[model samples]
Target: MNREMMKSLNLKYTKKREVILKILEQSNTPMTAEDIFTLTSKELHMSFSTVYRSLSALTEKNVIMKELRQDGKTYFQINSHNHKHHIICTVCGEVTPIDQCPLHELENKLTQQTGYQITGHNLEFCGICPKCSKQAHNK
Candidate 1:
């Protein structure tokens, strides 16, 4: 978690929400709602619905990024100050961060072509990781 994210989270803080944020901050990769509930429920009392609703609120506030996987699961990660995207593994639901943004030229081009002042952009890349590719080949 970054300072900006902490400052920008405009929602009222609750025990469950604080627990969820701590879990996400400690996590290296994005996790699904079930994962959040399972990890925190052992120490805290929270329902699955409460976890999901908390996720929705956090995402709305941009405290976390909601990633939609090809496997039909939604994952959440802490929204770092760095602007980056993810490359997900379709086989095992792995998420890797891509440190570079490839939208600068494209956003400029589109702005000039369409005369629309583009404010921002989002891009997510998904494919089989090397391990998954090798596993598939061995099979």
Candidate 2:
């Protein structure tokens, strides 16, 4: 979490945001707002709207990233500075961060072929996870 993020949101360093950031930093996987709400409400007795508000602020400042799935639910995760993509499991919604950009070469080639300036891209690979595949086989 950066100081500027809080300042840009016109918010000070509150215990609420700190807790939220701590949770995100410690999590091994991305989590939905509902997941965070349930846990934080239990632990901090925070109001649902407050949690939502803080999440919105964090997201707006890019302190956190939001991924809206096909299910219409948005999952939130801490934003790392590295450029990364995700591979999602359609069966179980498991998401794995991909370190290597699959389209890096293609992007370079395209840049060479055309003079158009490329800024950014979003890439997601969807498939069944290993655990889901195993479960399907067992069934």
- The root-mean-square deviation over C-alpha atoms between each candidate and the true structure, in angstroms, is 3.0, 2.7
Error of 2 at 87 (Å): 1.9
Q: After superposing candidate 2 on the true structure, give the runs of residues whose Cα lies further than 4 Å from its correct spot.
A: 2-5, 8-10, 109-119
lDDT of 1 at 82: 58
lDDT of each: 0.84, 0.81
Per-residue lDDT of model 1, residues 1-139, tens digit only: 4445455666777778889999999998889999999999987999999999999998988888886766778889888855567898888877788878888899899999999998656677889999999999999
Query: Against the true structure, whose lDDT is highest?
Result: 1
lDDT of 2: 0.81
In model 1, residue pairs whose N, Cα or C atoms come closer than 3 Å (at least 3 residues apart or on different chains), thus clashing, are none
What stretches of model 1 exceed 4 Å from their correct place? 1-10
Model 2 has a clash total of 0
Candidate 2's displacement at residue 59, Å, is 1.6
Least lDDT summed over 10 consecutive residues: which range in candidate 1?
1-10
Write down the TM-score of every candidate: 0.79, 0.79
